[model samples]
Target: MHLIAIDWGTSSLRGALLDGKGHVLEERSHSRGILTVPAGGFPGLFEELFGDWMRLTGSFCLISGMAGSKQGWVEAPYCPCPSGRVEVANAIVEIEPGRIAIVPGLSDVHDGVPDVMRGEEVQIFGAMSLVGLSDGLFVLPGTHSKWVTVKRGRVTGFRTFMTGEFYALLSQHSILAHTLDAQAPLDEVAFLEGVTQADNGQGLLHNAFGVRTLGLFERMPAGELASYLSGLLIGEELRTQSIHGGDLVLIGSPALTQRYQLALEVSGNTARTLGAEATWAGLHALSAIHIANKARS
Candidate 1:
């Protein structure tokens, strides 16, 4: 069976055509994300890309991410956190005439703090399939990073951090951007040094400006300084969150996976790396789950 899986994110939309075995047959991406797609443009874009497949195979479609947000095609309410794949899949919104289903995101209120996530829930589900049913933590690193805990196939609880967005703003938009250059390869040694500093309990807010100062006063190279700043932010996240001592699954691009792996090591933890293709795995998993649910009904 062929399936259409859409991984719609805030900044981009990625779709894959996959066989019954979950091997990708073809894939496509568009920069026209949730922000770019006008109020009613979903149908047009969906048709433009997959109209041919719809005519030929009439495959079922399952989607995750901002596609279910208020701005997207439909508003699938969030399934509060601490829920499992079965719970999330059960909450899917059906768009009929065609069998397109949107997976609801997750949200919860803990300690008077309300948090939400969209894309990472699918990722967690996909990761669970690969790692098997276990009690552990899954760490997804991106614009909005998530630290998710799973036990017995249910996502028990999770936390979100603003590491990626903070890095972007500090490196490009903040005053620190003026003092640094973006032209050099990452400096592994300097990065580890920042991790060490963070592990030693140096507060992140206090250390953030030190990046610019290091470059200006001590002649720290721009490239190494950039990597150092990145390490500092990520290290602070690890330190504050205490991500060590658990089974850690790091998800992101290879470069990011490596960085997080290094951070985990510095913090006296071990982590297994999941490839960036986990997004595809997630989309396909949602598609298969939805299709099976339909068959049962």
Candidate 2:
């Protein structure tokens, strides 16, 4: 059966029409994120967005991301760690019986603190499928970067770092903001320099302050400082992680992943990246699980 994989996040909504083999036939994206819809408007909005595709393809829709959060269409309870697509599918909150359902996000505990992930789990599963591995270290870089650990196709544990958010706060609202261009293209030299500095014995607080000093002392140009600051933050994140075996998979947009790729290389590690299509493939994989379970019962 065809699948409609909808990744509805806080700031954007995107859908993919997938054939039986999980290949995307068509895709649609919009700014109508979960926050944009009214309290009672989710069903109406979903229908408006993909009603045609559903009717035409006889597709079963799987909604993922913030759309399954407490604020989205319906809050699907968090499925605990060590969850695979089978567990996720079993916990899915069905909106229309067999026709539509929301994929529940995964939850894990790290050092006595609880952690949760909504959309990133789908990407991780998709990345594993694409790379043909059941176990690996995966990092999803975004506003809140995630470093996830998977064992035998089930997510065992993960950690979240506010690297991107911190970068935004520093580059836009901190003293470093005065000397940095947030939108400047990546400068590999300046970025790698920052990466090297981050790996030093100095911690993040000390390394971060260097961004402003580099500008104040006229040591580094204002144009390259943004990339430098970014490298420092990403490098700090890498420094904290405990990477085990398997390929270190990076999943996200190219621009963000490239910097991470560079940072990973400098740290003497290599990475493979998968883009947004991972979301589509992930939902499709979950759909197959749902279907197989139904047939068994």
Candidate 3:
């Protein structure tokens, strides 16, 4: 059976028309994310994005991300940790009679702090499957970077860091605003210098102020300060959370993952990147389980 995979996030939506073997036959992307949809307009928005592909009958639709949040088409509850495709498949909501379903996210309480992720779980599983990995550390970098641990083909635990958001707030609204030039091309040397500087143990707050001093003293050009800031924040995340020596699987856009890969190398760890295709692979994996369940029932 053909499948329609939808990755509907906060600010964008992506859909793919995939053959039975999970190859993309057609795809569409739009700026209409959950936050952009009008109240009670999800069905309409979905149709507008996938109307052409929906013309086919009996094709199953699988959705993930904020579309399953409390504000989305329907609130699909969280499945606990150590979950596999079967668990996520069982949590799928029948949004429409035998036609559409929403995949559930994963939730875990780490060190007594409750945490949840809506869309990244699918990508995590997909990365594992694509690399033929049964266990390892996986990093998904984004607005909120995720450090995940998979064991025996299941996600056991994970933590999140607001590195990107922090960078944005500081560069645009904080004291570093004047020190950064957003349009500057990345200076690899300055970035590595920041990463190395971050290991000084002076603390993030104190280290952040140094960006201003460095720019003020002309130690580094203001144009390259953004890359330095990025490296500092990413470096801090790696220093605190990363294990020193292992092959880390980095997943996300090439542009973003490359930065993380460099930071990993600087921090004495090996790394590899898996592109955005893993999201579709994961959705397909879940849908296969759903199909099998339907057959048995």
Candidate 4:
């Protein structure tokens, strides 16, 4: 049987046509980002872009990122924290006329600290499948980074950091943009130095200004300053979050995974990197699980 899996994130909509074994047969991507979706354009945009894929695949499953939240196609209610595979599997929402299933994101409120996640939940499930029933910590680095702790096969707790998005804003639009240029290569030395500073307990707020001053004083090369800034932010997360000796799984794009692995290593945590395709794999796996459950019911 054929299956369709969509990873509709904030900046892009990605779909994959896969076989029963979760191998991708064909893929499609469009610029219909969640932010670009007009007030009433979700259904039409989804139909126009994916309608053909749906026709070709016969029946397909969808798990969206921004689309699953209150701001996307439809709000798939959140699954409370301390969630498991069963909770996620049971929280699927079906959009009519098509056999499309929207996976609900996870949310938690602990000690009056409310945390939320949308798309990374699927990626975590996908990564978990590869690691088996082992207890470990999963780190998905993105615009809004997520650090998740899983025990056995269930997600016990997780934390989110606005590292990527903050970097983009500060480097491109904020006051720091004046001191830094955009098209710059990474400086390994400066990047490692920033990591060391973060590891030593310098909060991100304390260190972000260093990017500007270092450039002004000509202490660091202008072209590689972005990497230094990136390292500083990621390092802060690694130090403050406390991943230490637990098994660490890094997900996201190749560039992000590589940098995060380096940061984790600098912070004394060893991590294994999982490729980008894990998101699609996990989505397909969840779809298969949903099908099996329906059959059993």
TM-score of 2: 0.96
True-structure RMSD for candidate 3? 1.2
Model with the higher lDDT, candidate 1 or 3: 3
TM-scores for candidates 1 onward, in order: 0.94, 0.96, 0.97, 0.94
User: What's the lDDT for residue 5 in model 3?
Assistant: 93
What is the overall TM-score of model 3 with all chains considered together?
0.97
Model 4 C-alpha lDDT per residue in residues 1-297, reported as the tens digit of each score = 677788887878888888878888888888777888988897788778777767764567666587888888778998887887678877888876347778899987768988999888888888888766358889999899998988877788888899889899989997788887667766667778888877666678878998899999998777778888888888887777865586888988888888887777774678887875777777887787777788888
The digit string of per-residue lDDT tens for model 2 on 156-216 reads 9888999999998999998888888888889999998888898898999999999989989
lDDT of each: 0.80, 0.89, 0.87, 0.81
Q: What is candidate 1's TM-score against the reference?
A: 0.94
Candidate 2 clash pair list: none
> Over 4 Å off in model 4, which ranges?
none
The digit string of per-residue lDDT tens for model 3 on 1-297 reads 778999999999898898889998888888888999989999987887787777786688999999999999999999999887778888898899678899999998977898889889999878878898878899999999999888888889888899989988999998889888977888887888788888999978888998999999998888889889988998888889848565579999987898888887885677878976888999999999988898899
Return the clash pairs for model 3, or none: none
lDDT of 4: 0.81
How many residue pairs of model 3 clash at the backbone?
A: 0
What CA root-mean-square deviation does each model show from the true structure? 1.7, 1.3, 1.2, 1.7
Tell me, by TM-score, which candidate is best: 3
- Better model by lDDT: candidate 2 vs candidate 4: 2
Ranking by TM-score: 3, 2, 1, 4
Query: Could you tell which candidate, 3 or 4, scores higher by lDDT?
Result: 3
Candidate 3 regions exceeding 4 Å error are: 244-246
